[model samples]
Target: MEFASRYLLRPSRICFPLLLLLAAAAAAAAAVAVPPVAQQEQDRIGRLPGQPHVDFAQYAGYVTVNASAGRALFYWLVEAPASAQPAPLVLWLNGGPGCSSVAYGASEELGPFRIHSDGMTLYLNPHAWNRVANVLFLDSPAGVGFSYTNTSSDLITSGDHRTAVDAYNFLVNWFERFPQYKQREFYIAGESYAGHYVPQLSQLVYEKNIGIQNPAINFKGFLVGNAVTDDYHDYVGTFEYWWTHGLISDSTYRILRIHCDNEVSEHPSGACMQALETADAEMGNIDPYSIYTLPCNDTGSLRRNLRGHYPWMSRAYDPCTERYSKMYYNHPEVQKALHANTTGIPYLWDTCSDTVGNNWGDAPKSMLPIYQELISAGLKIWVFSGDTDSVVPLTATRYSIDALKLKTVKNWYPWYDHGKVGGWSQIYGGLTLVTVTGAGHEVPLHRPRQALILFRHFLKNKPMPES
Candidate 1:
């Protein structure tokens, strides 16, 4: 300043001590402001092959979750537009216990781009969730997608508990890598098997932040779509959905009820397997996940099956999208742009991993207990179901919510979007349940416009619009 130049900057006052203090102040400022932006630059996606031009910045890379085990998880973060900066951060997971959230959640459902059939090109998603909030997609559990561990044994042992811990670790490291998001309101979301992932992680975050007024992660609440909630309720509701929807015969429904109840879904008994097989056969070539959509006609072997009967849960209504992701992600050029597969993973990338899911070690039979704890803690919770997904149908979600026994704050009613019914919603004391009309397991993929409305309402913690 002019005054500082005349008084403070005099030759008499500006000595060795003054010079050193100025240098220290400059270094401290650089340490706080310069590095994080530079690190984000390193992860910036310059461009994707045949990708459409976009205004928002995108970054993708690995965050090491376990140093001792050389384990890491992959993430793709699509930021909100400049106008939405300081927006809430939402972490989206896709459940296979082993699926890549980038593949499903990012590319197919809510991310900005959809892979072209050429697998080498991309298109913008009109209803990407990033329109309203910063969206982060993660490929969790060291063995899924591009995420890997130097220790091969870790792959076979991927389970609910370990996956949650590693994801938490990823958040810790990721915040250090991009400190701007630290203390930002955060939420986790997923579908199908992630029904388990989202809530368990929510519990960990909620418990860890018990005493801190401003924890770095600042986890607020969660939203899940067509999620697997509890074994007994899921079993009862799934079988009932099949029979009432007329997808299975009367006799098969009886068989499922008799054999499935009380049986751990992760380890179904012989009688339960027989009943499920009968149901599968009876359902025919229709996609069980969507129930109404035609399946991808690639070779019969190309169908991505869910882990055992757990999700038969949502092989999803991907049609050829999964195939496109397989083709696109395996391309060396796309991988390079995304900064993925850096260590030369021996196998090609995939949308889902059967090995990881089939060998999953520690899936609990229920997530209702976690729901109880988080709900009591006043964490915002919302569960949405696509009415048509036989995999984790609305009926099953209803049964699970009924088991929670939360008092109803608002009776069920149709929620509207643009003058038409989008879905039905009900508000409960500590949670909310919404049913997206005509949607399948992948709600955003099936009814994107309605899904976007649901998401906007969710982020605002407002009830779905009755208009």
Candidate 2:
């Protein structure tokens, strides 16, 4: 299976002798008043090996979630520019059941910088989400990214429930380390499989806040893009999308629909699997994440090395970015600079971990019940989609939302960005549905500016701009 395809099925551990070091670090941290600025500076990224100097502050480190199990989740925090006032805290996660948010979210998408073509350097992302909020990117479940565990069972047995619990534990401990933002308005954002992560985590946070007069974490809302919300709808929409886009033959589509419709579970039967295989063969080698975009060739060379003008050349998109990220992250110096790869993980850093993806358990067929609960609780909720994404396409998202039967507050309309129609949105009583025109599975990577605008509106609890 292709790397991205495995993520659709996406899916941690522990230790002990390190207590002395953690106690010493805690003692040292407690000894000082450590103003917010100074404490942030303490976690400051002095400089990435080849990154450009920037005015904003950045921090990367780990928070031990299960000390007994020696499971620690890594995080990267990019504070909003000092002049932007005290911005809200936004926890950003990338779905893969096992993908690294630090790799994809921080470097490839909405973080302050993007990995350069050389794989050793970085460039500013002018539309980084941190411009409006303190973006916190986490690598969760103890086996993704730099996060690891001493327990082998954590790696092979991780599922949705454990992941949400671990993530919540990470946030509580993270707040203790940086108490400055404990009471700040907070939000959760993520994409893809995070459709599960974001809502599940949000629900936990909400439950934790009950009866607490002054909760340290003031979670305001959440947003998800191109998320996997409902398995049945996702399956139907995906097949329909393939057939409509002419990526699958009519026979394959019919067979898939016959064998897979209403198959709520991610696991499919032998006949269904065969039909999907036929559909995949019909789709060929195109990048399923972004059907309209060119697939990255397996050649190790960077696309920037090509001097001639090519139709696929794009300043905003790089199909080979995952390759660059792998090279950059595996560099020993880079790992040291980020405070990652601590304890010397046996394996090299990867964009996604097959072990985690393959072992994922407890993924419910639908998140609709959770969405209904959150909506009833009056939390701000927004769902956005990248129209060009074949994997978890807009059709899937629309179908899932439609199942909610939300009262429409505003009929569908074109939302503008700099006077150009960026996408379409429909405001409902408790939710909003949005589509980013021409974007793919990773919306921010494909349409950074529009994604930023969408994010700003989401945080502000305002409707998408229409002109």
Candidate 3:
């Protein structure tokens, strides 16, 4: 998954009179004084082209984390429908370690709308998480998505620790920009590599709250799905999953076990790489994200030609949504609507960033220590896996959780949604593990209804319903 940033006019300059007029309109609409926080941060405002009419107020803009270095992170905040009342804030991140949460999380997954195949319009997501929480999707680490830094070194080198610190800074400043939500309950949720991001950022938030008489941000628990936790278990479980699912040959699996076992280094050895290549060859051209789903064979040219017409909308699940996202985000009108690509970034918008992925500086072998620390602090923790995600399968999550050595508070049981088995769940001493049946790497994208049920349960701090 490789992503490129887009280039468009920066929206930093606006006349004072226009700003005053906009503030007056906002204040009158909400029937409240327009605070400075709202005035300063609400510079970028416009309805997305072809977006459906909605009652919720949506915003997109940048939060400067480092002024001297020209570093800023892009964010899209989709507030819950006004009728739902003020909702808790949930920061949604997508994994890739370098992916665009706006493109994936907001546009494709649990956001308010899904991009139509025509790449020029949108459709309402009936089960968007914003229905339950104010969802904030961020493109992080200064180089991912619309986030950027004038310092080239910053983009070429990023790691877990720096990312956590920067994210904390972003939140603190973001709160300053949106004072209304400063004291609101906050929860972090993400998938894939965000297994590292969510826990790491939560730990920072928890540590910063210590000894403070009153913390501005009411930090709460976190939830991750198909997350990458431990390297050893992840690799072992992945190989085992491939073999068991008949995606790899026995000999290839055996070779991977011997060569890549416990190979958690940031850079694998030549032998391990060779073994992985062999395994991938056996896996073929199937969609690794959702093994059972069809892969998108549409080329760039084909996508461009389907500009204004409904390209292809599947009656069921469409695995080709990623292709549509790329098309949608790259459209000049769409970028202008979202106030993205404002700096005229040199590349086209992409789902995942190649620069960030390739330059990822540090990846801890395991996040178990941080998990243990957070769990001991009495924070709510929930881990979910989409059973069909071969990249980080349920087996991998099970193995990682097993390493925690926590007592099972409840025996495993099937959880129901729509009067049918949605998945299975088990409660541990400090955490809960859940599985979304027939889902893949991106749980919400694969099982929107079930994912919403899982999210609602997580927010309520309750177990999934069993019938």
What lDDT would each prediction earn against the true structure?
0.79, 0.81, 0.78
TM-score of 1: 0.87
Across residues 1-467, which tens digit of lDDT does each residue of candidate 1 receive? Answer: 11111000001111111222232223223333336557687888988898999989999887778877767688999999998787999999998666778888998898898887788888888899999999999998777777766666676787888999999999888998888899898999999888999999999988988898789998989999999888778778877888999999999889878877765354567887777778878877776767766666633554445324233233433467888988988887888898776533334677766667656688777899999999999999999999988777888899999989999999999999889888899999999999988788889998888889999999999999998
Lowest summed lDDT over 10 consecutive residues: which window, candidate 2?
Answer: 11-20
Off by over 4 Å in 3: 1-36, 40-44, 298-316, 343-347
Query: Which candidate ranks first by lDDT, i.e. highest?
Result: 2
TM-score of 3: 0.87
Question: How far in Å is the alpha carbon of 367 misplaced in model 1?
Answer: 0.8
Predicted structure 3: lDDT = 0.78
**Per-prediction RMSD in angstroms?**
15.6, 4.7, 8.0
Model 2: CA > 4 A from native: 2-42, 264-267, 298-314, 343-347
What TM value does model 2 have? 0.90
Model 2 lDDT per residue over 1-467, tens place = 43123234331111212332343234334344555445455666788898898888889876778777767788898999999869999999987777889878998889888887788888889999989999999997777877777666677788899899999999887887888898999999999999999999999999999999889989888999999998888878888898999999999889888987854254567787788678778888777888776677732354455324334323658887887898898888888788665444334678877677767778888899999999999999999999888888999999999999999999999999778899999999999988999788999998899999999999898999988
Candidate 1 all-Cα RMSD: 15.6
